[model samples]
Target: MPIYSSDSDNETMPRTKLFGRQRPIRSVLGGGQVADVLLWENKGVSAALSIGMTILWFLFEVAEYSFVTLFCHISITAMLVVFIWCTSAEIFNWTPPEMPTSILDKSTFHEFASTFHERFNQALSSFVDIACGKQPALFFAAIFCLYILSVIGNYFTFLNILYLCFVCLQTLPFLYNKYEDKVERYAGELTREVKKMFRRMNSNVLSKIPRGPVKEKKAR
Candidate 1:
C-alpha cells in the first residue's frame, strides 16, 4: 500500500513540499506576508542590520569588552523585560502592546518552565547516547573528541569569530537562494563522498571491535 493517497499526492506530500525543499528566497528573507511586522520583514533592512551589528562587534573588540560582559548585558536586559512585564500587568493595570499578558501570567511561566526543562533533559540524554551508547567504539570516541573541542572553544573564542557567524546568517541564505541548484548539486556530491568514506571506515576499522555491554539488551 502507498503511504499517500494516489489522488492527493503529487510529486511531494504537502508537508514535505512546505519544509523539505529550499525555502523560496523571497519567503526566507521576508517577502511573505506576516501578521506581525518584525525587523526581518525586508531583505534590505535585514542586510543593513547585520552589517550594523558586525560593526558594533568590531567596536566592542576595540573597546576591550569581555565576552562575559557582553553576555551579562544581554541577560540583564532580558531579566529587566520580564520584571517590567510582570509589574505592569499585575500592579499598574498597564501592559505594553508588544508584551503579551499571557507571558506575564503566573501559570504561563510555570508551563513554559516545565516544557523547557523537559526539552533540555531530552537533548542532554540524546547527547549522552551519542557519546556512550550502542554505537561502535571508534564512533563513540570520535564524538567524545568533538565534545572536548567544543568545550575548549569557549576558552579561546574571539569577538569576531562569535558574531561573524550571525553576520553570515544574514547574507549566506540570500546567496544560497540565488544559487540554490548549484549549491545543492555540490552538497549532494559532497554527501555521497562522505558516505562512501564512512562505509569504508566501518568495514576496515569499526567492524573489528567486539560488541560491548553498552549495546547489550537488558534481560527483561
Candidate 2:
C-alpha cells in the first residue's frame, strides 16, 4: 500500500472555494496592473504631509464655503448627467448600475450574526479579565483621565480633541517604533540611576541612625 503524504495533498489542493460560490474580488479596483498605492508607505513623508495639511487647514479652512459650493456643483452635475444618460433609452444606450455585493451574502446573515455574537462575548470576557487583573493602576488612571476630559470637554469642541488624538495615534506610534531601541536604552539607564540615588539615600540614612544598643555612660 502506498502512503499518502498530507503536505503533498495540501500543496496540490486549489483555492477554489473563493471562486466556487461567489466571484473573487480583484486585488486592485478596475483590474489595474499596479495595485493600490499607499499614502503612508513612508512614515516621514506621511508625517510631513499630515503636518502640512493640518497647517493649511488651520490657516485657511480647506473646505471654505465657495470651494465646497463649486465642488458640489461640479460633482453633482456630472453624476446627474451620466446617470440620466445611462438610464434613458432616448440617449446613448447604457445599462443600469449593478447592485453592489458584499462578502457576506444575505443568505449568510445567520452565520454572520453568530460569528459576531461569539466575537463580542469573547471580547467582553477578555476585557473583564484584564480589568480585574493585578496592577490595574494604569487602567484606572486612564479611566479617570477620560472622565476628567469628558467633564471639561463642554468648554471645547470634543470633535477637535478627538481629531487631534486621531492624528497623534497615526504619527506618534510610527516615530516611537522607529526609535524604540534607543528610547528603551535611555529609559533603562534613567531607571538604574534613579535606583542608585535611592540606594545611596537609604545607606546614608541608615549610617546616621544609631544601630547598636548603647551602654549608659556613668553620669558623664
Q: For each candidate, what is the lDDT?
A: 0.60, 0.54
Candidate 2 structure quality by residue, lDDT tens digits, 1-220: 3233354454454433221333322221112211111124454645665776576455334344355666678799988986776678445565655555775366446644665576688768756765776548656875788799988788756445755775774555444445655655556556556656666666677557877888888995
lDDT for model 2 comes to 0.54
Candidate 2 has a TM-score of 0.37
Error of 2 at 108 (Å): 20
How far off is residue 101 in model 2, in Å?
12
lDDT of 1 by residue, 13-50 (tens): 23222224566655443332220112244656566666
Model 1 clashing residue pairs (backbone): none
Best by TM-score: 1
